[model samples]
Target chain A: MPRRTTRGQAAAAASARRPLFAATIALAMALGGQAGAQQACEVKLGALGPMSGPAAQWGLAMLGAAELAAAEANARNFTVAGRRCTVSVVSYDTRYTAEGAAAGINNLASQGVRFVIGPVGSPEVTGAKPVATRHNLLMFANSYAKNAIGPQWPLVFHLGPGPSEWAAPIVLMAQQQFGMRSVVVVAPNDQGGTDIASVDAEVYRSLGITATEEYYQRGTTNFAPIVTRILSSRPDAVDTASSPPGDSGLIVRQLRQAGFTGPIGHLGGPGTEEIIRVAGGIDVLKNFYWYEVVPTEDPQVRAIADEYKRLLGRDAPENTNMWLWVVGARMTLRAMETAGTTTDTRKVAEALRAMPVDDPNVGRGSWAGQRFFGINQELSLPFGAGLIVDGQNRGVRRIEVGQ
Target chain B: MHEFWSAAIIGVSLGAQYALLALGFTLIFGILGVINFAHGGFYALGGYVAYSAVSGLGLPYPLAVLAAVLVTAALGYVYELFVIERFVDDHLATMMLTLGLYLMISTGLLAVFGPQSPEFSFPVKGSYSIGALRIAKENLVVLAVCGCAIGAIYWLIYRTDLGRALRALADDRQVATTQGMRPRLLFPLAFGLATGLAGLTGALVTPILALSPSAGDPVLVTSFLTVILGGLGSIAGATIAALIVGFIEAYASVYLGGSAGALVLFIMVLVILLARPTGLFGRQIRGA
Candidate 1:
């Protein structure tokens, strides 16, 4: 039979175990420090993107691309400044908001990371650019904002050309395929939406097609009222411009349910797969056209998925933007390797700007943002235009962007 | 005229859903004197639980919804009884606890389900057309179910003995305890009932729209706004306010475009709050 413990005895017993708890904590910290000190060279790359919202697919793609590139570089023994270094990625979920991205940049900076490979929306880029510049961190950002990569932000590089470069051709192709005379572009009223929708609408107007821009508040779950408003306009087609895939899918489904049978276009980023999934299926999607970041049907381009799986031990993110982001991340890593220093962001930026825009998977591309953002730091890779006619998949067709 | 009718249909459907959500939100605050910040987590959890029951366990849709309500209600009951009970009197403490719970629930869902909207859809597809005005059959089902749930909640709170005890406790805890009412026993029941309503709403509505881990983020904001406008502790106010909010959102979004419409809704709420600090049907705040 154990004796009943008094309060005094309990206090004495707790005091006796305090040293052991402190010692355990000290030992863990010491081991962590020792592991860090033992590493000869480690390059920390920040991967910032929305990881938990409707735009999560794009952000997850960004993270996947960064991880894949880092893994690939490790396999080849990525060397910087004559020292073999292992690349590690630090990711922060920006939640597709400006403040989230800005804070993420500061967080990465606090962790001694000098480069970043994400923040994949207009508002995020807008928020992150100032913080990234203030922290001297070079960012490879992807945004369709008109001022995505301007002269003001020299260290910020665009992941790919926005609607400024690709929208016209896609609009032309869509027009040819669907023969639509008028279209309504629906998107969130935020910077992320307005910038891209306005550009896409301008392209439609340029092509002699009537385009109406209907902006909605972000975080709107149901689009029925908006759909009713859209139907009131009675447009020939509806283009979901930069609305997160979830929102776009709901809009598409609602439109169809409301008896709008015309072709639907996603002139924003690459999220057709997510849209199709969320909108039920291809049958529910009916006639659809969208921008594909790369010619997904091309074996050379499709090989990236196989490589990602081989290297990362997991299937690649389904969003096609992952392929594009892989190019961006791999290029950033290669630039650091070329410049021979991960800490010197300026040298890395210079190296990246000077490096020829070429990828084994995406083929050769040109840097062409001077006409749009007044900076020639945009990666204008060849992309694809995908289509679905009457619920039939009409595979993506490759389209080249000349500098 | 067609657009008017379409917006009205959407408004009524949205009103029913909002009323269900706000009633739950106001219930926890009213009786328990604790703002359940994890209300949205329960909503999202409800959606995921139903999704799992149907998709993982191969249960029928109706059964899945029932499972969602039971699971969420039980979880809420346990959480309130054990964790929240300790800090029920401390507003700040309860707020922190509920908020932390929300974070855990959302993060857990994200980890388990991943950041993609699963292919869960309303079983009934297509819409019923009345000339130019079209309403999704799924929305109609949700509206009807929400109406019944609201009615059931009213009956439970007004016509039942449990309601009288709960209301008695809400009016004067010290007196109610002296009069043979056990707060510890009734509080959990009230909490479970409220969360079950949220769960029911989530199960019925998410499939019609979309279901994701973060779906509850907006739900929480909208519910908070609606409850505040309705006078925080008034059931009648919450019901009327939800419909007002729904109609305002639909009509404004339809007539004034989406962006302006949302702005207008917030401004109107602000104006109403300024005009009546206690809300349209609110009583004076009781001193503990």
Candidate 2:
């Protein structure tokens, strides 16, 4: 049955339905907007290091750290500036050279990156610092140079203390075990090499060990001549101070082949595995000692490997530097989150400085580069001194900061 | 005195290896009038090929080296015939082509093997000690092999009929072609021979030292320096120049230290170039 109604009644009914339609439209729009917000506002982090050539392991570790941190941040549903954001990383290979690092900074800056995580060599950091200053970018760099972190570069931070902080303990421990009376420290003739070798030699000499520093050209492949020169001195120990892992390995192999059986002390950085691989085997490194950036044997730190594999769907880099770098990268992201801004690097830097130097995996550390680099921007964490006595790995012993 | 004799022994060993590399470098420039920037790529490829043959395929070390030589030589022959032959006369074009190939080869190696130096060691272990002088058995093996290779190269270039034709083409390409000597056929063969020598050197020396993708970068610089110091395109000049470089590098590194040793060698080369603009053995002009 059809019911007849007056025009005014029909108009009234239409008006009433309009409100419901409006309500439905509003509800749909709100849901769509929420979805858009979840996928919006990208924040990019930059990594700079030698991703190729001999020093590639260090750089790959840096990049890996950045990636793992980003993945973890995203997993936590990281937010910045009060909006849901996805953190991404862009990497540039510095080739372990000055010009390359400078150019890398410029390139990263062009892509709107305000945070950088690495430039793992002295030359690269030196090259990147000025350019980073120009661009107002915050950097977390790793280099053994004396000036790796200085007050002049307010935005720069160090991943951890270098040979300056850790070399003495390693030297003392090595001396106690190996009883090396005379040692030769071999490195490249560049600033990257000289700075560390000199510091190491000073440490050795202060301990009353006869120390001599020998510098070779950076690209010298065959270390035979240098090895010969080293052997002729009849050194009780040879320290491959700050030489790239590949170079150090070749020197060790050649030394062993030449029948120089003194314990090889690498008071530089971690590359014991690479050196062992190149030198043939652990037996080739009959007696060896090295510096590890962190107490790698620590269960908490060891868990990072399992976590990285779980989250990243692959094994972490072979270099233990990966664990140290993860702390740097995670701290950077946390600072960014605390500052509530991705573009404002100054705020992030301030936030980083104010925050406690602590990590779940690496444990706790304090900012302590004031006496050396004229700034307190260096992360001084507990590191390890590794030993191999009679071709047997004694494992890494953790040494607390300031110990 | 012990140090002096040790440096000399090292210098001789180094010279032999350098001669093998430089001879290959000069051959391409001499016959094709093309600077093969990819020469180093062949050297690195040879090392990787040998490494894979031994490590991946379970071949014996000697067979692996031979496989490396054959594979590199064949690749070089194909590359020359197909790509490089078109622009062989255009030096700039050939330079660009070779440089591009070098990049490709290096990048490919990096992708396949990664950046780290693989665990590759010489089959012969230990060293021979004569009094206070010590030499790695591997180094002596390399030196002996290099000496034999150098002698064979001389015989091939100076005595063989194919060598005569190749030299005729180098002397005057247009005339040699008019006289029925075919560059299209012989040029590829020459390039193959050069690249094969480079591969042989890499297969021999890399195991003794280290085998990484970037290992070729230093090899290229050394080869270029040796070739330029001797005389580009002059086989004898390259040989003499390599020995001089090796001796200087050894003596200077030993006496003056590694840093100053490299500087001294460069300064000596600079002085030589200043005195003789054409190099120690270079001619005024190439007939080609």
Q: TM-score, each model?
A: 0.94, 0.95
Candidate 1 regions with alpha-carbon error over 4 angstroms: A1-40
Task: Give the 10-residue window scoring lowest on summed lDDT in candidate 1 chain B.
Answer: B279-288
Clash pairs, candidate 1, are none
TM-score of chain A of 2: 0.91
Query: Which residue pairs come into collision in candidate 2?
Result: none
Candidate 1, residues B1-288, lDDT tens digits: the string is 999998898899899999999999988888888888889989999999999999999999999999999998998999899989888899999999999999999999999999899988888877888887788888888998899999998998899999888888877788889999998898899889888888888888888788999888988998999988999878999999999999999999999999988999999999999999888777787422
Best by TM-score: 2
Alpha carbon deviation, residue B261, candidate 2 (Å): 0.9
> How far off is residue A5 in model 1, in Å?
66
lDDT of 1 by residue, A29-147 (tens): 99887676447478888999989889999999999999999999999999987778899999999999999999999999999888899889999999999999999999999999988
Candidate 2 C-alpha lDDT tens digits along A118-158: 98999999999999999999999999998898989999999
